[model samples]
Target chain A: MHASLVVSGLRKVYEGSGRRVEAVRDLTFTVDAGELVCLVGPSGCGKTTLLKCMGGLLTPTSGEVLVGGRRVSGPPPGMAFVFQEYGRSLFPWMRVGANVELPLKQKDLSKARRRELVADALESVGLADAAGAYPWQLSGGMQQRVAIARALAYEPEVLLMDEPFAAVDAQTRADLEDLVRRLWRQRGITILFVTHDIDEAVYLGERVLILSASPTVVQEQLKVDLPQERDQLRTRVAPRFAELRTHVYEQIQAAKRGEPS
Target chain B: MTDIPPEPTRPSAWGSLPLRVLFVFALPALLIAFWWLTSDGSTNVYWPPLRTILRTFPDVWTRARLRADLVPSLLRLLAGYASAAVVGVALGTVIGSYRKVRAVCEPVLEFLRAVPPPVLVPVIMLFAGIGDTMKIVVIASGCVWPILLNTVEGVRAVDSVMSETARSYGITGPARMRAVVLPSASPQIFAGLRQALSIGIILMVISEMFAASNGLGFTIVQFQRGFAIPDMWTGILVLGLLGFLLSVVFQLVERRVLGWYHGLRDSSRRSS
Candidate 1:
């Protein structure tokens, strides 16, 4: 159950083409082992860039991301990423089972063991029946599930998701948000999800990190202390939930106004 | 997901089926009909009515020398195309993965592809000898660029996010290419191969026609030299049929390889 991820004074900037744009500035955050933290930010606020830096997909200008107190020189050995564009994220040519099995192949697991893990992952995502199907053969929601299954099958200690459900319809997005909550609670995996949606962040995260406009720094941190199990309707109406959402919403507005909150 | 705009599927409703079928078949049918009308003892050039050409197919097919020529030509095409697939795909993969490799090779390949295969026919015939090897080289060299360029297109076209996703999983080095890059790039790769297949066929006939004393090209030239108009028409018809058949075969394979993508788009369209 030990799955803490620590990001310390991380700074990232894009410097090439003789035009430098700083993306993340002195971003410091820590997710306790098995905690779910949602990052809510404005567009171009570098939330995704921060996640990319944490996931080692982009190099940080300085500082480090540590998984279990070990510095991440590259993608952490036990980490996974789920992207927003599920259609582009999953390999269309691969069957659902094969796509899920891809990251597992890099593991030392035996073929039978890998099959078992893949089955478990797909079943967890309620996609066991689609093991033989290809990603393109599924709906956008289902394609995203295959992507989740791909990450799950990797047995990552930390899962980094960048707007995973943003492409789906409203109903599908709600359903996926619930699915993610279930996994977060059940597995206690360290989850860092980045999204522009405030309600989604309020709904799923145990903690929400509000980021400022581009050249992003942490605007505020709000702990979600609502009931552990959440339903979209009931939770959205909860008094504490409204209070927290309002606070995050105000912070975003302040960031937009370029005012300190 | 991705915001790529999809092409509309051809209407397959009952009313459209015949029209669609007619649309595809119309041009060739009209050409054949025109040939029939003009060559029916009415015109001197473009000799032989369509019927005379059809009648000559069997005689053309069964000739011992024709069998020898056709078999060798077909084998040469297969070998050349296969060689092109291997070398082109491999080189393209490496070039596609490395930016420096792509930059260095892209210009050279673009220039080479512009030069038609016929230009190389004489050079190959001189250096490799006027043998099967020379024709094979001619076809291979001519066809490889399409496959290579397509492979490069396919490989480069692989979504950057997918590669990032793979890298974020600690699936580095060769594993990343096989698992992520290759499958993602496959649709484009298949496109290149299909283009190469047709080019391979065209190069096959043209190379033989240029330098060799063998193959369908040789037969066509032999007919022309002997002033046998119908026989020459028969050779052209056989080549057309062969080209059409190769194209059909590749289409079938393309559908199979990209079946998932095709099915998904259809389903999405239906749902929408």
Candidate 2:
């Protein structure tokens, strides 16, 4: 059975120096097995806080996140996270291949098997020749590709990406979007992508979960009725793509206006 | 827009290697030449000619007692510095990683760190006697602070996102420390080591000067007291050369160990 994610009433309150800031309040969502779900929200909407809660990086003030029916108290074994700051997330000291192989070292895999996995992941990301190079030597897009390779090499059941393409240029962002879609289809790995870009959410996910401003809740979860085989140019210009984009865009605006959905 | 500037030409072959070396050694060579020329015929009691000091170098250095003193001094320095390095890194890692440990030890460590090693030589001699043990203890106490404090700072400065990344990947315990934390903190740690090496050398001489019967410092002092002015000059010259050689060796080792950090920094600098 494919691993699914269930974040139930996940509320996160940051208490510091007698001041309580409720980041995510009573938020509930589920991403089905093998599904590509995009979480789109306004800035300061606690989308990152919610993702951290789901990944078990941050403990929720109340509620819990479950992966494959097991509550996540710590980082779940089947999950891998791709952080927004690719520069900081990937180890600068390690070569691209070593960076990809690092998480696998924790697994009980043979050295040869780990090497093979790193090679395959790098190849899949089109960074096969860049394996020996350090992350700092690569361009921003290439570095992010290495980050993706690291996540892919882990062979995770659920991949959590926190605005993975935000730092790259438009063209590179489109390329990465296709890369994510291809990987999801090829591996059937469930993905929960968090982004602020409405168009990106529509272009990438099967369903887009819209989040409201602070004391955040799921404002709406819209199903994207686009074709499975999505292309950057063709899929984006499609009538259905525009409709889905506009729908998500308007919902985010209304949510930002503090309207209760 | 202004016209583009022409590209700068590379230096000539002579300028690249031969001239570069000449330029680097020019001041020292000139100073030595000046000293030799000025002291050629001097008959002053205290300021003996450079020739006499040069003549006495072989006499003092080639003696059987030279090995006896020099070897012991080097061994003590090595032992004390090695012990300090191991203990300092271990304790520093513990202090840097956990908040509780750091909070408890901060005040005590600071107080101890403020006291110089030379100052402790007499105090240490009282407890341990005027022996190798006392000398080593004094050297270690003096050298440990730089390494310990640097390690603590390095470990504390590790990027939060990087640590989070490590945690999320299930890289915990010693594996995390070895792979992520140590490497991240390495540049700072190396900076500490470099600082400690110089301090260790200074302490080595100071500790021996205070109590030990034989060492470079003791030998120099002995020559001075016995009115062997040329021998005293030779001793000072040998100590200077030793310090220079030690620093050169340390720099080579540092370059090898911190090659990755340099490469990363250089590439980033070029890109920016």
Candidate whose TM-score is highest: 2
Q: Candidate 2 chain B: worst 10 consecutive residues by lDDT?
A: B1-10
TM-score of 1: 0.90
Report how far residue B10 has shifted in candidate 2, in Å. 15
As a whole number from 0 to 100, the lDDT of residue B221 in candidate 1 is 88
Q: Write candidate 1's Cα lDDT for B1-272 as tens digits.
A: 32223433545764766787888899988998887887777445456677777787788778786678888899999999999888988888899888998889888988988998788888888899988899889888987887888888888887887777778766778887777777667777888888888888888988888877789988888899988878889888888888889889888988877776676667668878
Full-model lDDT, candidate 1: 0.84
Q: Considering only chain B, what TM-score does candidate 2 achieve? A: 0.91
Error (Å) of candidate 2 at residue B237 is: 1.6
DockQ of every model listed? 0.51, 0.42
RMSD of every candidate to native, in Å, equals 3.7, 4.1
- Candidate 1 scores a chain A TM-score of 0.97
Put down candidate 2 lDDT per residue, B1-272, tens digits, no spaces. Answer: 11212222333556567788998899999999999999989998678889888998898898686688888888888988888888888889999999999999999999999987788888999998999999888878888998999999999999988998898999999999999988998888888788888888888888878877899888888888999998989988988898898889988988777766777777666668
Candidate 1: the clashing residue pairs are none
TM-score of model 2's chain A: 0.97
lDDT per residue for candidate 1 within A1-261, as digits (tens), equals 443888889999899989999888888888888899999988879887888788877779898899878888778887889999998778766788988888888888999999999999988988878888766666788889889988888988789899998889999999899999998888878899988999999999999999989788888888999899899899999999889988999999998876777
Interface RMSD for every prediction, one decimal?
Answer: 6.2, 8.0
